[model samples]
Target: MPLTGLLFAGLAHADIAPTESDWGGTGLLQTPSAQMAQEGELGIEVTHVSPYTRYNFTLQPLPWLEGIFRYTDIDNRAYGPAVLSGDQTYKDKSIDIKVRVWRESHYLPDVAIGIRDVGGTGLFSSEYVVGSKRFGPIEASLGMAWGYMGSRGDIDNPLSIFSSRFNTRPLCGDAVGGQFCSDDYFRGPAALFGGFSYQTPWDPLTLKIEYEGNNYQHEPLGEKLKQDTPVNVGAVFRLNRNVDFSVGFERGNTAMLGITLHTNIAQATPPPKLLDPPPPPRPTTPPQQPPEQVNWADVSRELQNNAGLKVSKIARSGSELIVTGEQTKYLYIAQGIGRAARVLDNHVGPGIDWYTVESTNESLPVVDTSINRHIFDDLLDHQIDLDDFQRSVEQDAPQPRQEEVLYQATPKAFDGGLSLTYAQSMGGPNAFILYQIAANYDAEYHFAPDLWWSGTVSANLVNNYDKFTYTAPSDLPRVRTDIRQYLTSSDITMPNFQLTTAHQLADGLYGMAYAGMLESMFGGVGGETLYRPFGERWALGADINWVKQRGFDQGFTFRDYHIVTGQATLYVDTGVQDVTVAVSAGRYLAGDWGGTIDISREFRNGVRMGAYATLTNVDGRQYGEGSFDKGIYISIPFDLMLPESTVERAGFLWEPLVRDGGARLQKRYSLYTLTDDLDSDNFDDNLQKITY
Candidate 1:
């Protein structure tokens, strides 16, 4: 499984929910409905799951009752011409919604009643469970569920075997020659299963064991094969406030391997003191007299009266104009191209200027040699199919997921290189422009095909470093060898420069592009090597992007390597809060190629704070060796308090997928807090009102 899902495993209260719902989340733990209410009485739980990855978010909505939502899906799929021919494949999604009826505390047994697979293709089944009892160091629980089930045991296609080359027709083999195959692969009705779990009373460790199976409603389909008698066993260990681990295994017609994880949500593992809500908005007084009328012509003419300032109107629509102005302290606008927002804080200057420049005309660099020049004017857009990618990985085998890192910084040659250019109007429409010097170095590291996260991708321009590290049983592969060999032998270099442009094409629609090139490196068991062309190392593909805003502040982009990524958001005005929802699909065109989707929303009150859920789909290797690993993850930023001195945070990033996969998440989660450049000694003086 992808290591991302391991990010959420245990519960702070026990509502059986992960806490948040994110687009690219993965499920590494089970938060069953009945179990959620037992953990807490007044909490809410949100369960987010994908084809191969499942995520559960349970909370106490009340003190005595708990609400729960569980989402999980597995699209039965098969690849390779041979396997694909012998079986029928279809996408499947399972959703379970319920309200726990009770929890056995000191004297009584726990109970609950609710719907299972509620908003899904009903297997025509629901479950009722109860539990409470301790046998010395062992704790146990029992539960039963009844529902509609499907079984297709008698259907047999000839592709089942060790090699794809084998072709044995019924007439050519004993089993086939007998023509005994029956069309019974899909058949089943109501069934039963007893669920139970146990743990040591003295330690944080836990153990679980359970079996679920059923008898057919008609008769034996094929040769009276065993039913759904699946069994599972797992345990967890809380290493510290910042670290924890878990492992579990299940077997039957299908099997699963999993782990648990918990990390910082806020600066403290135990939440910080919630501050009292701010005072309500005060009533505004009506102006005693009408505002003084000022001559628009006089204001426009004043540009020339200012020190070395020049102003000219290039275009005009109605009340707005394409005005150009320049002075000793600032540069002029591009006619009607961009706009100017005011920030006249005395600490910085008289005011700040914002606008946009023509990127194609500004001489942008190429990063990936594989890509021709970025089609600057190419309007064709693409999107990542996260849902499809997740389904594909679940049916296939495991492959290496590509990871990269890079850095960049530009001098203050152009008003801190900030501009606000509006390409068009929507006020009619508010225009937007691309600003800020875009630069960064990219490093791509490969990991061993297992459940742990480890690798290194460093970008020199932005001073950003991404590291993925973890360990698993021998059954899983380790990435240490691959990373070492690549670093030692690869011809890839750092500081691959790139320039990005954020453009507003229309209302609720914006586009951005990043183009650059760098040296390409290849890695293997012994080491890595750079593929060269003529005597020069070949450059990687050009990194170009175009985004289409889906709403007031959300959009999706396509990188063109068979992947689609997008962002979603929810906004609230009480605190002027903003939440971001993001998703990524498809692999980097290498390794066990697949896609990942993540959904996260950010909340802010001047600073930044929020929780998110992420789901990732990779190939699985156990059932289908070489299968893509599937993963789910949930993470929250503990540090929203900005540093006092920092004019702008350079390399600091919280949007993990927006950063470089899991690298930024790991680093930000480690830091206690970031400080600013504002000196406390002068803080008091700056706060006093200024008089002319």
Candidate 2:
């Protein structure tokens, strides 16, 4: 599943029904209402009513914001030329958004304004302001709409009183589509739509009645649709928490059947760990035994197997024991911290006053935390509260230690893993979904703690390349558009093989450099540096790379396309809701000068939802269908579903189209992501784990 839901999962749903309309919105049979599902809800609905069948994917990214992506098929129309689309049905892609205006109270109704079919081919475009109210087990909705949903022209548009520009509805979208036409919204004519839904005596059944405004004579494609009566009726049956089934009679003449699947992401919880060992029981008595001779090897093994820490070094200064290691598992760094403290309490001698754990990744230290051993012992003996222990802890950037070294890790030269990978291509001319299944094998050879050599091999196990016939035309250098060729070039390919190294340049500064095949389509050398103040909510980073396009076969061969691309980015945690904004001005892969803005927020469940758009010097017409480059990405922590805890994440990126205008090279790693926990906000969010 795409992990793009966030924040408001458990809000009350008593005011209105959490139902989908025939058009796949939260409402009645044919029109939308002001009611909305709980935030963080991701839903999919497929509804069919005569000449149309619609597939809708909706996400409530915010409590008041709902975004929908729809794929509508016209059963009566042909897709395109036979060679390009075969016998596929006509398909239309559209985007819709609704923003809440007011919440329902004792007297006021819930209200919202919305636009459908935004920036797409002119079909099914409409705008409306809807309000819904609930009384007992029944909910009622009323709204005024313009454009296709209001083609009946029941009255003059309300906006016409302000200006004559709101009196005419000119054509929207370009010949090839994908353009937003603000002038077309709330223009032309207007009509009223209203509906009511009643919850039945039975728990799972709800009945609906809607009065639609569209007469069905002025369809966008000029096809004539029939309307027996404006009144439509429907019933929804809730099958489970995440699924709904419905049947409806729409236009008073057509039959509609639909199904919806909904899931709340912000409320996601990982399943119980059935395979891992439990934490050792807390000691009942305080430490009274005198200090004993310690076997650091046994302690290191215990730390690795029981605490999920790959212990590399153990040192002692006075009464403190400093353990340095990588976290091999546990997405919640707090879990590791608590386990490490517990493990050390049992393994170390009573002389130790503080237990410190310095967490690193590939040998580069990111966070150093210290816990008062006495406070932990007191808490174990019921003498101190967890809050007291929390107050006694300290965290900072990795510190320079003058402790006597007790043990150092032996070099483990190499490590690797293999897994099955799946990839997809959507909205193609010939096929809606094209995919490939492959075996992914990757390995890392450690040359030193701060340096390593890594590479990955991908071999196709199965694919449907013969159906992949669409190739977008680009006037600029094809940095990313030529993906189809690369996917089918050979059964086996090497996408990346880079040598990377990093080191701390100063107190809050870090730097990393890399060379070799940077990605599947590009090979280059680049370096990135970041300055992240340990207790600040902001950071600055910059990167520069000189890259050349790789051959289709993805071997040790390069094409004659090369460019110098670089960027200086500013990252800020807005603090309003954990939203991070990154603004970057850079030279793109096609030599276009532009800036990209990325906004993202992490939910309570460790899912990151974000969207980004890039604007370059290229004009919309020359840049083609999607205009500028834009995409949405989702990163889901593996621990959410895995039996054992791990910090790894599965990621998904989606774009409406692949164009060459504002493309950037995909880096294997970034300093910002590598040193994320070093930032004050992230570290603090998980800091209380020290007392767990």
Candidate 3:
């Protein structure tokens, strides 16, 4: 029997399990294949093929969609003398998107359509449609491709039959590289390609054979390459679930090698370490007598040490006891409340049957959590369950009885810390990577309930700023493009020094005002107000700033450039896939009128993946490299990797290109983020952690 017939015959009775390589995405080699990473999975792959090297980061943010960012370097070409004296190789960045058009069934194949280099230079641009089906241990795929992938032009442009415009492709030059070339997409001649992957009995290995479509007749930088044969062979060796190594011989000539590191970001395993002890055991029966009077000072210290809450005041009204405090630790608000309940049970008088815990941050009231003493005791004693307890707890506004003040503790007025800091910038013409390491000192002081001062200073330890010499090619005012100057001009700098005050203006409205040096690039005074009803799905806010650009050394001196910038923003929680969309219209620092849209999805583990884009009145040509500003960001909560719980998080952002247009002030605070716990859904989701 033929190979196809033999594979089909085995499919009838063979029982085979899919392997690690089977789950890796398409385009494993140079040709299009049919496979996809699992949803929520993230992978980073590095591949080398003779004169070209590629670094690819892929994220399956959705089940049926995959987004990829690739940075490719032409090992033989220079970045021009202006950048590193022509010592560094030329690199190009591109984005790829793949969508599963159809999923496989018993009799149907899995089909996918993809576009490569969507908003990048035309060097590696292509579009393809592919399908694959599994038979026993073998999977096969076949596809038609166009653009760079189909440069061989074995078949005429079939689409040209409908319109002659599809017969010819246009070369618009490198200046328009990052703009989406919609007119050129799938417009050139077409070619056919196919591939198959076979899983052997050996568990760690999988073999691949592909028929590449590229003829190598047209190469980037005006070089024509030779192709001996289209057939290529390769094999992948799984190092583990998170890593893989592969090698291939392509075009019957050059050899290719690659390594991939992958993991499901949503399901990452946290480090092994000790956690806080569980809440104290609940009383089994009514107390025989009233509890002894304990020192309030001792109770305050115990609350801070055990529950990670700093008590500001303790008061009683009738049959209720109220504790106003700030949370210093614990990522879940319920955990803090649970521990506090136990502390209060042992300290408060028996007459106080109701407990009200009012939480605050930066001296701002966030939420008031009400707990019935009997319900908490019932739940902790196993007489009631979580759902029952949740139905009894009350979350509402703080209405402190001012008639009596039982106890009040002096708040900590000053705190500071020192740590090492690192900052990086990439994708600019000056260098592929520029970075600085410094010793950072941060301190904060609270003067009043609504006012505070905070500052951060850095002393440079090591850097490569000497290589940052390229000037930005922006026609507008150099609001942000002077970053190279700021980075190189300072060895020691004060990045932030500001005084801020916040107020609860009304029932659902909050306000903040900030002055002094806000960020490294600008010194400004600004005020912002937000209207967000507790637990509402939408919010509205506005901010205005009057600012002057800071000196290159990051000193207090002002620069010639000055402007007033502001924005009116709207935020909506879409309820689908935990996604949130934010839209803002504003006057930017460059005096351009524009708007921005930011969309992000937060996972249950507190990992956020999102992207934002800004479009201004500046013309595409004048906006330079990327036409506009756009980037992707990921925020990871510290508790995901740490044993001790914390509300802190770190963020990483990547912008394809930075220009002067559509730039806004990098403010230090936002009301929406501060008031997150006010959302009832968020509180309810965390109620399971309640123990006391």
Candidate 4:
């Protein structure tokens, strides 16, 4: 999936100022530069230059890395025959990346290396190494390139000096397209490109000029144009910190216009929660009053209202008050526990020395969090700080609390959400994009904490998927390619219907089972289990499901196709660069034996971007277009966009070509997500928020 392009990041470490280029990266009008946006910086850009209209979504997931996904519409070219392509213009999809090699300094310029077209049709394939130096308000960049970027043949092959293999540049972009084209990298006549941008006296305007690398003779799909000049000029107007508009003239013939919407995700935060109840302020000094009379019923109400916990019971174990409940609102377990501690402090006896929260989900034990009352009080009284308090906090596996019962809670048996979802498939033979919009109704009934029934009913609002007429030929089972049929099946569809049960099998061990309609296309039974030591960086999980294909109409019916599928997965959270990796191997939906590796970066603010690829036993040709299953995905916290805080996220996954060979089930739930407290990051991150 890294080859596909991820779409999230935070800040940049480059000293060179970033400018959105025609090709989507940080650069001048027609060529890239050594500049890089901040990590977690994300941008959506649209550029038009003569015969090309390009839409680019670029991301800086790390300070030193940038990735782009671009779609280009070429003029005067049809995708194919009118009947098959519906008069659609030629559309090209490509991925690109840039990485910071060195940060600029007073004595030296910033440097970078990059690829223009990675694993798509090699229409704009090129590689370069560039450097940018700043002088007062002027910034200049110079770079050498190969492939399309070096079409001018301004110089002989520089890399050929090292090996004769680099003397010849091979033609790329296979008939099927989407090839890696690695052998063509930096092998050919090279070109020199340089540019300079000047910040004008006018605050909002900047001017730039760059030398052309390509002569316009070697073009995509054999299209050709005459180069009137080697120099291009552009001017950019910044409307605000997040928006920019630019216009330019390149090749002395073509006019260029573009707009970019950019923002940093890691630094972004939700607006103030003016609508919710505010937490009680910490006291400037510890209370010296006598033990106060307490009402257990009122304590339960306070915990539910202020802590977002659906309390099961509250008990006392000597000097400790233990509360067993499920967090129903807060995104982090520490948030819920911290809030509960505040309510307990006011309601319990003054002698209580410890506050413990035994968190649960669907009645299954999660983890235990205990905070020393003296340390908490000391912090509240300004006698200690967060650092001193953390030493007294303990998080571990659920523990037995044979204590005195005080308060009990009634069950709020059902909860769900109503959401609108927009689904899309892009770059099809018949159409550039096919999209569907639907309204979903989710419902769940709790039989008890350990068992429940949950399902989703989605009603189609509208769709433009009628043009989904082409299906790539696959030698394996058609487990996933039939998405078109499923999408068009009915006005109302029940994609999921299941009864599930889960319980804690042991310390660091959990188990779950479910049966019924498991997903839109499959139904039957499945089970999963996970072993995650509290506070550890690694976890092991496995899931197995036996399912039958569903009918196209999505009715209460099934097709004859059936198979057993499963996977054994290991997840590791590498503290370096806030990255996490997941490795899974087992049976795939198409009866293929394969494995998948997923890599992602997560920020403390709840924004995550990742890519994954799966390889199966089948040969590349047998697996159909694009070879195998691979995609990029991003998950953003809904709190960032909503008026009020919510423990929900918006997610999007981009799959270039969805095939069957390495397909995996889109599970309704996972232990990794259900019990996210298996790791200590959240606890450490949210510790200071307790008093707030």
Candidate 5:
């Protein structure tokens, strides 16, 4: 769909200039001034968009262009998922490059174009564009792009939901043949969309209208498909500088009202003169005798007379009071002020450097008092929700709020998962959907022997149907869905019906094992029991399993398999000042599955390296020359260096890129790799990889 205004709202903010921003992980040269790079101010803006917080980073790259990077995390919204019965999450990390093609200074409206990257399935790298321009009183914008819409689906077949014509069978053949037949397209097929909008300048109002359409020419479903369209119209107003209101309607289905603010960092500073030079070494006057009853009035008046003191009337019901303000000239002044207020300065003024020990200790007593009065209430009120503050640290680092101390915890673990899945037609020519979700979670668990465990769950489901589609010819009554436009009448076929399920399980030596319905399907059971033996880094594990395949499935043969797997793991810990690393390795053996080796290493900075490879051959399979899919996938997530202001002292800009969990400064990065192992007939089988 059109991505207008989605990048930058039409506000009287400084124009975003394009400057080279350092995206830590990737290598790129920094662009300097004079190259039309970003200039002026740099900052982050965050707004609570209901369930999802809108984190927007704005940069004035130039007078005509604005760089806006915004992402929405729906994880904070609902508690669970739809369609799938587990937790579901949707995250949009969009990078919009906006350029102002035309601008008439402060009076003229500016026009800009933006390109956004939308993640999608193979064959189509979803992308869109928006163009906005101003013409005197009527400021309007138009947007258009060619790409599919919606989040990437975790479907067995990528094409099952999107354009099917873009779907091609997975490459199947001998190594050489597979190389030549493999599908080259990984992004989804392209779709087209367009939209436009209009708005006004002062009443500070904005109104816009737009439309979008997608063309499915080569329809991925192997058919000719019609296009789809959606429209939207909306307006936004500035209630004042800090507050804004917006309302919009989309395709007659979605309506929205949004209120937002741009909070300016408040800065309280001492006058430049007092801060630069000492107060003429406070005239060497004879030490005044300490007052007896404290003539508070005359003392207050004299204190007000002190050049460094500021006096203000503090009306009180019982007394006409005066407040004496002492500005701490520096870190040193804080100490002197504290000492002076308690002694020589008390009589001259109701001297109270509340900001020192008193102010800080004041809040402590409030907490202490509440805790003394009602410990449980205090505990509940001050309950440490680490997750809440961790999320807060991620959003606004420099200006972290009260609970930001949670960021000081060390990142103790790194976990990741890789899955290999294959599905095809089986018994009676019916298609089957079979896949396994294998994941690993390993982190330092103990002191001497680091405990770690890895497991995989294999599942296969087969459905027999008369036809894949019902819209086939009358003769093909077996087909359940429409496939008319998907293929030539002669090329269509019927669906076959079959039922199947695969069983998978896992358990610890003392932990409980509950197989439930899984034990009934596979006619066999499989799981592991593990224990930490001598050291925290060492674990002895064993797996017992029985597997049997029977019945008449064409490409499949009935077979029975059994095996006891034994595995021993070792972990070594290395500490370097603040950086720590733990390396672990384990080996397991089974019948046809042979012997598998797993090695993982975690760096203190959040980098993780893991590799799994199988070596032994069984079940009439060749020893070291079988065909198995082995590949390495690496993921490096370094700290996203976002400049922020400290929340406690919001005015001071601090380097919050590298966080120490509230301790010493720390930086984080990660790396991952997956490789294929030889001698495996399953090209997609990751266990056959040599290195990962």
Candidate 6:
């Protein structure tokens, strides 16, 4: 059985019903309620409401907070027909945040405050506080909304009692809309909105009715939309646990339809189907007294074939046998240990009283796990249970004392493979979809334990880059916006080629140095150092780089652009919901001084999703389209999709718009990531899944 199967051995499997929600929101039609998705849940929604269509991606990064990214298209507005060919619509990108103030109780309702379109063109911006309560099979919600939601002026601004400035909202400032217009926030007239949802006897059906606050008078693109009535009705049909379908009659005139696909990233670990068989059972009884000579070669082969370990060296210190090796297969470190223990029992004699397994990654030591030979022997013999065996094991830093060297396996030098690669860009004025599919050849040559040379060559097989014509407007150096030129200029390209060396300088201190073609756009030299204590919640690091832009063909040729850039970074593992915050500040590729803040949540299955925003000295208008650089990315471990265990991962990043403002060097490696095994708590968590 796989490690995940062993961890969740007896859990029952059954159909899980989908939760009720609006188009892309967790509430009734047209208005938000206090409901929230389960923690670690990710949802993608596509909603169409006549003149406007919204694409939403939502994440419950924390129990008390929900983050949303949306791209809305105005069906009635065109993106300058004279400047572009074919039919194109004007699209706006926005971000939203909602925070739960209080949870629901028997007598109290769940309360939440939310801001919509915080830093976008003030087209659909709104702020509101809402509450929801459940009674029997029905749930009720109510709220007061301001800004676009209250544009009908249904009632006088009650907040004006405190200040006359709250009576009217100021006109939106600039066309480039990255600035947060706090002056207009919650200042205009307010209106009341409420809704109710009913769970029907049919398990998959949910009905909703809402009285919306917005009258649809102030629509995007200076078009006045008519609202026949304030009441809206909708229904959600649960197609399955991961999908939902919804349709509604909104504004008593327009028909709305949407679909949502959701999944719990933390619990999506599938059992491994392709794995090595369990280790051979322990000897039925103690072997004679001791073995005069053991076949160490056969023992090493067994450990490698069955335990997923590549032994570097094996030696004896006092009465304990130490095996130093790297794990290449098992996802859980303990599983590897469990299997290695059995291999030791069969090969070594009773003279070896203890077994010390030192695990490493790329030849760098990670942990030293010591096991009681007798305890493990008893468990394998069915005389004791696994829980008791686990209680007898100890783990700490490796203390390797040279005594008698038994064996040292040959190290692998060169490894390479070919794989399919896809690159895409969307939601820009030039083209709705621009993509390239290619065959990528990746190879790595290991020089020593912690040093290697790696590179990737991509050959385009299919693409539509000819349609990419829009030259993004930017006042600063074109560090990234000239992506179209790069894509169209090369049918065969080299994206990365670098020589990297990583080492442990001292306890809890790690360092990395690299040079060559760092990325497709730039090539240079850089180094990074990080100080992260074992089992600690925080870490600090810094990096500096001097790079020059590579030619459009992604070849050895260099461009005129060159700059020195770097950042001092801080990382904190916030105890809430496996969240991590990374902040970096320094100089950017465009010679601008700025900082970036990134917050991400790691699921139990190694799925990481996060958002980041970069701010620089460049003005919003000068930076062009997005005002600033911002994007959301998800890193998925290949093991989640493959039947076999792997250390590979794939990353997908979505940026609303690409610009030149806050471009950072795309370094291939970082010290913080290289030293991840220093986290002892993570090792312990994976150890708990061990089963022999």
True lDDT of residue 309, candidate 5: 28
Candidate 4 structure quality by residue, lDDT tens digits, 1-692 = 11112222222323323678998878998788888887887788999987899999888888888899888999679988898897799988888989999999998988999998787778889998899998988999999988888899879987887999898898874465566778988888999999999999996899999996899998987888878998999999987666789999999988999998777776666556676567744544544432334576777778888888878987778888788887776765666777787776655546788888888777877888899987887787789888998888987788775787776677768988898988888888878878888999999998987899999999999888777877667788889888878887688999999999988888888899999998999998999999887778899999999999998877679999999999999999997878999999999999999899999998777788888888889766787667667788888877666555567777878888878888888889898888876667766866776775
Query: Which has the better TM-score: candidate 1, or candidate 2?
Result: 2
TM-score of 5: 0.28
For model 2, residues 510-553, the per-residue Cα lDDT tens digits are 99999999999999899999998887788999999999999999
Per-residue lDDT of 531 in model 4: 89
How high is the lDDT of residue 130 in model 1?
35
Model 2: colliding residue pairs:
none
Q: Higher-TM-score candidate among 3 and 5?
A: 3
- Local distance difference test, each candidate: 0.25, 0.83, 0.77, 0.82, 0.27, 0.80
The number of the candidate with the highest lDDT is 2
Off by over 4 Å in 6: 1-23, 82-85, 272-292, 376-393
Pick the winner on TM-score between candidates 5 and 6. Answer: 6
lDDT of 5 by residue, 391-445 (tens): 2211000111122111111223433444333222211111111112222222222
* Shift in Å, residue 60, candidate 2: 1.4
lDDT of candidate 6 at residue 398, scale 0 to 100: 58
**lDDT against true structure, model 5:** 0.27
lDDT (Cα, 0-100) at 44 in candidate 5: 44
Worst 10 residues of 1 by lDDT: 669-678
Tens-digit lDDT track for model 3 on 347-438? 66568788888887677787889899879888887998899999889988654355356778886889999988667887666688888889
C-alpha TM-score for every candidate: 0.30, 0.93, 0.90, 0.93, 0.28, 0.93
The weakest ten consecutive residues by lDDT in model 3 span 1-10
lDDT of 1 by residue, 1-692 (tens): 11122233222432222211111111112323234422212121222222233333332322333333333322233311333223322222233334556665777665555443333223322333434344555444454433322122222323345433322211111211111112211111222333444445635555555443334332211223343434544554445322334455543343343333333221112122144122122224312321122232443343333212233222222221222333221111111111121110111111112111111111111011110011110111123232332222111111112322111111113212222211111000001111122232322221211111122223222211121111122222222112322222222233222233332233222333333321112111111111112112111111122211111111122122222222222222121112333233332322222333333222211122223333223222221211222222222222222211111211211221111121100111000011110111111222111010
> Backbone clash tally for model 6?
0
